[model samples]
Target: MQTAADREAKLQRHRLRMTLLSVANTSLQSVIIGLYAWAGEVGWSVAWRFFLVGAGSSAMFALIIWRGLNLRLKDPGLLLPQIALSVLIQLLFLVLAPKLWVLFLVAVLVTYNFAMMSFSARQFTLAWLLVGAASALALFAARGRFGHFGTSGVSIAILWLFFFLCIRQLTAIGTQFSSLRTQLSEKNKQLSASLERIQELASHDDLTGALNRRSFMQLLADERARAQRAGQPFCIALLDIDHFKTVNDRFGHLIGDAVLKEFCAVAAASIRVTDRFARYGGEEFMLLLAPSTSSDVARVATERVRQALEAHDWDRIAPGLRVTLSAGVSQLAPDESVEQLVRRADEALYAAKDAGRNRTVVA
Candidate 1:
């Protein structure tokens, strides 16, 4: 795991790189204009030429900054046109700056970023090939006018190709690193989710699809803490299969499993969406109703859920063993913990068991 300091260091490095790129891009314009004047082929005022170079670069970099700041490559068809425009601006620099053919060389060198970034490797390679051939031909043409093959023109073209090739390699390496980082993050997320699911399965009953006793209490504790913090209320319902063991002994455990599943389904269907149901243990279950409620409201819901489960047909599952439920209901006491509320409900449940066992009891 990366510490906060490590992450901050990496972020600082990235910001520094972007800062360097933005500054270099803007500064190259003035450098090219200066080179042109140094070569003594211009009929233009030096100050005005420098001003235009600065102004043009400022506008173009501002535009690129606005577009590129929050962009991601995975977003399809997003920054392609912006990069193309950058290339165009660089080409325009080459065309306008007449004296400093070296500057034209630099402009071409710097702005061909699109070849590596916006296009595929094959496309970039092909474009570089064409430009290399074109540069050679242009050099051959300029041989009679300039200082022949020994002129700075030949060296300028070679350096331009070299710079572009270097930038391409750098871009490819960055792209690979970025791809690996994203894959690792996605893989970590998947691993985290899988572990959570495994923990849930271990702590929950398979038949009823509810939290077993341990997870139920843990969840109750969580809810209790939230309610205490907010100074609110929470309600719970404890339900049991009315004659689960009898059903198992008579119709077999498989049939009893079906009854347990059907009972949970019916109870789940009966409760509001805010209710959380969990298998407390064996044939017992618990529900955590959020946003609190009165004792009367809890009792009404519990009775309604019990009646719904009893009313549901078990014949399709067991054919002969009838399945029903007895539930004990409770509301959060003032400043009570999960243990206190559950104990009260558990007490009520056994009370229901003591008082002839096939009904709802309230705590």
Candidate 2:
């Protein structure tokens, strides 16, 4: 068995792997943008400082997060530093290459999504504040670099507002979808439980909580087929409560019900867990021993049930009330039908009743 600590460790490792994957993907954007500028593919001068600093800082932070998570640290403050690093990196890129301002949005969106998945509300709020402040300051710094200061500032502000609104709506939708999924999952579990209970009630006896006669007969047929195919023998025992009518007449129907329940309890307790016990009909029961059980084992089990019922303290149920069981045991013959096996067991039960009241007779 795994300890709670071991399970928790496994969960932590999985979470760490997922976090690392997201971080790596996000950082790759910075590397690609930095490479584009370094190659002089864009209009901006190839400021090697900006490219090196942005890519280097993001790589360093990714390493820190990976190492910290591997060390199993649960510190919330870890992301605070990363958020500050993101803002600083964005400010560097914006001030150096004002034309690449769209990259700022990409950086913020990536971090925003990651925060929604991994960080608490407080941490996410801190990230948003850092992002917003960096954007405003970068716009002020790039006043003459991109276009007219007024037009650029207004344009940046409008774009930021739209982005914020869209992100808020997306977060709300994600939350709503998560709640619906949870509700659907719970309903599915409840429906499955109800179905299982209905199946059990349909197949089990209400009186003794055993397999009903029809289900037991079906199971007997399947077992007979399996025994014949495998060339293995099985045993069946037919058990009856001795003088049950007299008991019911003397003790009333309620006490008779109690006696039947108690007899089932005794017989059930005496049999192996692999054995099948079912109420055959009124005042009668059947037991199907496993294919591995021999006739001698079935006989011994039947005798054990008889002795248990005879020795049980029956007075607690009703004053001076006693009950006993007589059973007939039969082993399956090669290629014998289920009906033939049951008939032999039934005949042996009559022989037991005729010979005496409380003994097991084997056929």
**lDDT winner:** 2
Q: List the residue pairs that clash in candidate 2.
A: none
Q: Which lDDT tens digits does candidate 2 get at residues 1-363?
A: 899979766655654554454344444544444444444434434344544565565556556555655345555225555556656776766776676666565555555564554567786787778677877888898888773212354445544554565465456547746966897899899999999999888888887788889999999999988888888888999999999999999999999998988888888898888899999999999999987779999999888888989999999999999898788999999878889999999999999999987999999
TM-score for each candidate, following the candidate numbering? 0.53, 0.58
What lDDT score is found at residue 314 in candidate 2? Answer: 98
Off by over 4 Å in 1: 1-153, 195-199, 222-234, 332-340
Give the runs in model 2 whose Cα sits over 4 Å from its true position: 1-151
**Candidate 1 residues 79-160, lDDT tens each?**
3443445444444444444334554455455545534434777867776775666556544544544421225774465446
Report every candidate's CA lDDT: 0.66, 0.74
What's the TM for model 1? 0.53
Cα miss at 316, model 2 (Å)?
A: 1.3
Give the local distance difference test score of model 1.
0.66
Clashing pairs in 1: 36-100
* Reference-based TM-score, model 2: 0.58
